[model samples]
Target: MAQSSRRSSISGPSQHNALVSQNQVVLYNASSKGLTVNYIHPACHTVEEPDASTCPYCHRPLDEYNHSAPQAPTSDHRAPNYFHLLAIHNESTSRPLTPPHLEDEARPPLSSETMAEGYFDAFFREESKLGMGANGSVFLCQHVLDGNLLGRFAVKKIAVGSSHKYLVRILKEVRLLETLRHPNIITYHHSWLEPCRFSTFGPSVPTLFILMQWAEGGSLDDFIAQRRGISHGDTYQNSASPESEEAHMTKAQRIAAFKARTGAGASGTSRPANLKAVHLLSTDEIVSLLWDITSGLAFLHNRSILHLDLKPGNVLLTWDPNVLIPRGMLSDFGAARDMLHQGSRTGVTGTLEYTSPEIIMPDPMTGALRQTDSKSDIWSLGIILHKLIFFHTPWRNGNDDFSLLEQEVIAYPGFIPDPSITSACSRRGLPTELLTLLQSLLDRAPGRRPSCEKILLAIEEHK
Candidate 1:
């Protein structure tokens, strides 16, 4: 996998450093520096290149960002490969995005219409708050189409202050979400900006409203926390004949029951630190979700993008009444970047626990951390897999000291689960092959780590 450069040459503010929001409208202006002025980026900048040469947004000359041959899977769906599944799902479910010039003909001017009649009342009806953060809040909303409630969507409302750099970062995220289509990745719906006050007495700022597909099952971390309650002698064990009680229940019902006991809800909550142990997910479910996550990662890699942050919190779960397990979809791309044009790191990015050693470990000679690549993401995936099977990370500093954690991770020697976890894996029928894969994913040498494609191949072979 060769590295890809950032398509957009303009540097923007990142959500990590500035207030930001997520929404679904494309408005690009060549002169406007702030997001308040409707600077829409051309969708072509994020995805595979099109035939036209001029920039659709700025009417400036265009240059090819990616010259490499496309890495899309074969059209033959008859093959039993995991890539085929992703290809089929993407083709069937993802809508063809309209080009910038043809945007008016493709869809109604909903952006203007919503702005005329208050965004929430005219377009979507707000339901409940899903999650809130320093810069923005995500809400569960019902899409009001033709005077009837359609489907639920997660709308992220971000307060975009007067910062050109942050505006650019938000644009990068929106452009990526708008064009990147995959079943295991959250779908972008619509986005537009409106001025709203962050507080009652405070002045209003440009709040970006990003509409996206709602994952009903919350996040993977939420799922794990509820499962931990079950392991801690919660309702499942306390019930009279728990096995018989749940024999006819659906996956949603089982999870709901667990949530009721654990005080979990649609918006995820952190697991209590007191809960020292957690119930391990079944091997089948783990493998299935692994396939979902790896498939999404593989698609991004194919596009020459690196998901620098791949952790449980960033993986949302979508539940179906008929399906036995919830599907994992990758979310939160604030830390992701185009691997092809990546530059030297100013500081380490991503969650400390899941960040690869190559990114966090200092050089022996220069005493500076090395640049990361696709393999750095594989190490994060390995940590996720470890938490899935053992209910905890393989290595920890047990404190908030970054240096200590970095040192511990550098010396980790690739973890093999203890007897208790191995015994659980045995009872759950986890294949030894998977354990081998997990260890290899955490290999200290990034070059030795398996690519997402290789991981999917291993899964297909085992299946």
Candidate 2:
């Protein structure tokens, strides 16, 4: 690649801008800074690097998947691990996500030839809204077979524009979700794409519909609140107490308790509180929850998958329809990606508070984003564990999550749990092995972190 003899290196907003493509990647000059913008990163200075440079972010080569590695698994899992599902989901009334978890007709025919009505509309009927978020809304829908209500499921609807970038995200999520069959992970049943036009007409916007198992028990955040005791308004608490008092509480009782405690009649279902619930969990409850999540992560990382967002919100709880016991199941595949896939490693890809230090900081030598791998997931899990034990993450010592994360990212290569928090877990009978494992998971050096399988096996021994 060669550049013209005439070049400008303006520092601020200038009038000139030009697109530059090099080594199969496109770069552009900013009008103000005369900086090179990366193909994915816009308005950045010298963000595009040599195509041959390995990504400090994902730890993969700049080039996309180029090797004859194992082919990524498809939606149809050839070798299903029913035994894992049998352990938890089957114990109660759980069936395969089809048995594990639709259709609408008589609608004005879609004009877009590419609309996926043939697959999605033919089988599923969207009902009431179950949940909504910044990116999408989830609906409780019925799977219809020959006009019969086959079962109930949660369908996530994400609005998208017509673009390969958006399509890749949907495909990546579905493909990744499809391969995961562990009971601890939410079951992905089906997916479809449709045009975004019904009444309002404009450019043909696309949409994605992902059908997944409904976690009737809600998010782990709610579970933590229920197990811990939440209240409305200003609050103060450090640990989950009332373990003995809450021992006999069923999901209904706990939800009721949370409502009563949080003055839900005055407001609504409990919102996230900085304070912990009054009741702390017993050693057994804590162990079971930890084991469940650890097993789920093990299953994921074993397949070279990275759950970039492993926050409490994504860890859902679902009761066995038959047994009535609560089980922690991982959900939300939006930020997940295959490490072995074809592509350069990703940039920092998670909530800042839960993001690993390595991902936040840049490499001193390369002056680029530091390489982050599956070990980053381990760091996130360690933070989740801390939140479970201490009832909150010390992302920052001063004001808020952002500040806490800022403090840590700025102080990369150095982070340790507050000794008091670890001490509390110890008081609650967190075994020495498990505690060490936790520390290792959060090790500042990514290489020092244990594998998901090792964490699983070690914790199993403690259990």
Candidate 3:
């Protein structure tokens, strides 16, 4: 008797239905290698880039289909070659390659059981208060399980109920940081939600706890102050003209100031304040730091992420005291968000001093502040670099109030480094290359700012 054949069918949504469908069939040939047969719907044409829908012709969805069909038995046929049959089988039913572990799935959601574990209690215990901000309080916490006393971390505990928007912001920050892994960016260890009640608030609210690497030296603001020294002599010479003072500083003085301020004192060639500081930063170190930051920005931008709050405080030192160069990491993603598909209307979400002009200025026609974009981050970075080189913000002395400050930012978009500082550095004048980079980044129009990659390349080529 002739051998019988087995057939299988797959089912999926019809094209007429709101959801479309597709299907594929595999046939096992008794005398030869297997084959794949696709039965696509006529109406549902497969475009190069197809949206989520079923095949219009067959009314079957792509995912729903019978993957296998038995071969017909043939009495007179010789058996198929084993190797060819295996190859054909493999080709017909190959599975999609799995993505990298990091991209596998949304981080497993934090469970209430996990939250109730000692993780929260231990993190909050003996939390030496570090600082406080609009969002929450920062504390220096010890790692409970590791028993690494010196391995301190910063814990940011944000109380819920302020606003759902703020809660969403915190969640977004956690999500972004959890996936990012870079030396120049702060690391996110873990997070948990704790239920608590407050007397003033009346009802209890969920408090979110975020753990991060602790910056021992505190903010760059404090670091700069320490480098300049507390005495009047260490202060920028107010009496001398900016140009004249820069000219008078010796190489030793410049180097000492740079070392003292940046904490780049590894060479051990200590000289008195008379000589200019030998900017220990080789052309490479400066380039490296710039590259590091831009790379970080590029990563964020590629993922449609925006670090709305970009400032010196958000850029932290990585605690490398041995190296004779300024090494830092970026932190504080509390205000970051996805900008790929949506306009960011979150009003004025960054530091006042470093915010872009577009954010500060309201559109006259719409009577609303223009939304912030990746260019807003570039503008903020430009201001940050300006402060590093000049030791002051462009809008610092010009205004006493927010309104006046916004006016100043609009009027003078470029920051001219103090000539005094430039003149004082004997090894070289103010980093003109960095200044130019900053100017371009600070452009009022978002469209004009260079992409992060371009900025990184410019910094690398800076003389």
The best candidate in terms of lDDT: 1
Model 1, span 1-463: residue lDDT tens: 2112222212123211010011111122223311221223445344465622333333433233222333222111111122122222223332222112322333433232223124445547889989775547999997553354434679888876554455556757777876776778887655655556768899966566777778888888778767765442244211122322343368788777766755677774845565544456887888988998999999899999888989887899987547889889898887888988888788988887888878877788999778788998899999888878766675534325667777877777886656765675777888877888998898888899999989999988765
How does each model score on TM-score?
0.65, 0.61, 0.58
Residue-wise C-alpha lDDT for candidate 3, range 1-463, written one tens digit per residue: 2111212223233211111112222334444443334343343343442532333334344334423322212110111222133233333332111111233233453334323323344324546888778788887876432232223568887885434455555776776786676666776655655654535767756567776667665665555444434332354422122222333468778666656744555785654564443223344544555565676778788778888888766766654536555556678887786786556475777776677878877899988878777898898888766555545566533223667666767786465445654464334544567656777887767898899988877875662
Candidate 2 per-residue lDDT, tens place, 329-380, comes to 8888777877777365546677776778877777889878764578888888
What is the TM-score ranking, best to worst?
Answer: 1, 2, 3
**Comparing 1 and 2 on lDDT, the stronger one:** 1
Off by over 4 Å in 1: 1-117, 145-147, 230-278, 398-401, 417-424
* Candidate 3, poorest ten consecutive residues by summed lDDT: 71-80
Q: Report every candidate's CA lDDT.
A: 0.63, 0.58, 0.55
Could you tell which candidate, 1 or 3, scores higher by lDDT? 1
Separate clash counts for every candidate: 19, 28, 31
